[model samples]
Target: MRISTFEYFTSGVSTMNNQQASLSNLYAEISSGKSLQTAADNPLGAAQAVALTAQAANLAQYSTNQSSALTSLQQEDSTLTSVTNVMQSIQSLVVNAGNGTLNDTDRSALATQLQGYRSTLMTLANTTDANGNYIFAGFQGGSKPFNDNASGVGATYAGGPGQRQVQISDTRTINVADPGSAIFQSVSSNESSPVSSGSAANTGSGTIGPVSVTNSNDPANSSTYTITFGTTTTGTPPTTSTVSSYSVTALDPATGTTTTVTPPTPYTAGDNITLGSQTVAISGTPASGDTFTVAPANTGNVSDTDIFTTLDSLVNALKQPADSTSSLATLQNALTTAGTKISNTYNNVLTTQTAVGGREQEVTATQTAMQTTSTQTASNLSDLVSVNLPAAISQYEMTQTSLQAAQQAFAQIQKMSLFNYLSS
Candidate 1:
């Protein structure tokens, strides 16, 4: 086969150029320590790396969200602890006010202390987070939740009903705050004793005691009983005697039923009158037409369970004179209600605190899991794109050697060309 000088030179040049290109690629892989520099190097690996990068970005955002959620929850938790302490102090004051020996002046001092506590509670209810958002304002985070009402008796809640939540993970969300209404306004009462009171219009010296439950499971415990006093005449005209008597009437609000409960029974001072599953004593002489009422403590009404109103009412009653039987009865009733409401509010606050702690725990766990996932994803991505240093270095050295040999051979071949041979 006869080969021309042009063909020989062209073939040699092409072979050397290809070897140099391979050597350059190996050098790039060695220097950069990356097996795949572009998509064309490994399309499947590059696509997988893109997905992993996006995942890492999402994970980073979730971590940020988790941090924010933890901060808000921690703030709420701390505020609720303060509230619980204040509530406990208020409860102690209420119990002290219940002492029969405490006169109006002593009671007034207790009331003053309660007012201070009320102020503290109001501040706690309007607590704000690091970002200046109200923690208990529900969805109205930017607005204050509780403020003193015009009457100066209780606080008004201007927040929404919906609790705010933060997304901690892709499928998980946690409540970061609780509404003021849930914590303060709409507390539940656990008092078993029915509330009893003499009618304000009663002209009698009659006083009634708190209801004592004899059968708690009885259905009658839910009914409101009214005791109406009357005078009955027994005997002939000249020897006629008037007997003080009372009749019971029951109203069941759930079924909207009102019924005359029992026939007239003669009244005896200091005797207990049975009303359904409960009994209350009339300790003083009751005039004819006087009435007293016994009602369930928990009426399942929001207005009935307001801690602020309960406290305000007790404070006002404490400042009043308990010189008369009726006044004393009113004071006793106020103490009972206040004690019950405050205790229930304390429990409610504790429940809210527990929930906040639980959410904090969940957020912490999610952060740990997210961290682990992020580490695993990063490892997978590294495995896909990272160069094997030892293997790449060995391949680079071999390619460099081959390129050097090709260069030397091309130099010798160029000198052996026919024009060069004639010159020789």
Candidate 2:
């Protein structure tokens, strides 16, 4: 079979051109460090790399979210710890206030200390994170959670009821704040006189206190009641006087009206007084004309009955002089009731603190998972697009050698002079 010289030379040239193209491609891959620079090189691998890139980007975003959640949770936990510490100090004061020997002046001083603690508590409750978002404001991050009036005797929660959460992962979200309402406003108050007192000129060492509510009756239990003692002379010589009878008066808190009920059959000291769906057990002796009053206890959610309310009531009760037994009794009784409520409020704070701890744990776990996912995603993306450097260099050397051989053979073919052969 006769082959044309032109065809032979053209075939050699085409062969070298293909070799050169292959060698250039290997160099490009080595320099670029990407086996699949474009979809045309390896369409399926390039497509897979794109998908992996998006997944990795999402994972990175989730990691950022996890970091933010952790910061907020840490801030919240730290403030809650401060709150707990303040509450512990207040508990000690509550115990000391219950002592019967404390004078009105001594109790007032303790109340002043309590007020300082309240100020500190307000600061903690209104704490903000690194972003300056209020930690206890729930979703109202920009608003202060607790606001105290100028006198600092009372405070109100200004934030929302629900907290905000961040998505740390595709399947998980974590709470970033705890609301003040749940931590500070959810406590119930004790049944005692926020304003207990005795008749100013009474001669007996008797006192009256807030009525402790034994049976809770919502609307029916709102009246404030008062007790007045009467004395009678006895033992013929009349040297000794006894509290013979006492009348109980009910004053409607809603209306300023009063109803003095007839003395209960035997009106006696150390008897149980029931009014406003609440009860009061008064102990100790009382002189004639001595008086005591009982008022409503706190119910949850009433701004007038929050933890701040308990402290304010204590401060006011302490300021009053417990000069007589009746006055002393009122102070002691109010202190006892406040003690229980303070303990309960502390417990409520602890419950939320526990929840905050749980959220912190979730943040930690989510962060670890996100890190793992990010590593795997990066590996998968590398596998799909990254070039094997050593192997690419070997292929480049082999292609260069083949291209040189093709060029040499094509040059030898070009020298085959068909015109000289025809002359021979």
Candidates' C-alpha lDDT? 0.83, 0.75
Q: For candidate 1, which ten residues in a row score worst on lDDT?
A: 186-195
Q: TM-scores, in order shown?
A: 0.84, 0.77
Model 1 has an lDDT value of: 0.83
Best by lDDT: 1
Clashing pairs in 2: 192-210, 193-210, 205-325, 206-325, 206-326, 207-325, 207-326
Total clashing residue pairs per candidate? 0, 7
| Per-residue alpha-carbon lDDT of candidate 1 for residues 1-424, written as tens digits (9 for 90 to 100) | 9888788789888887887887787778878878888899899989999999899889999999999999998988999999999999998898788888988889889989988898888888988887898888999989888877789677778988999988878899788889999888865334335667667567667877766888888998789899999988888989999899999999998888999997788899989899888998976777798888887766776556667777787778888887887677667656765676677678878887888899999999999999999999989988888889999888878878877887888788777756666887
Compose the digit string of candidate 2's lDDT tens values, residues 294-353. 555443236534788778878888888878656766666667667766776887778788
Candidate 1: regions farther than 4 A off: 1-34, 189-257, 261-301, 389-394, 418-424
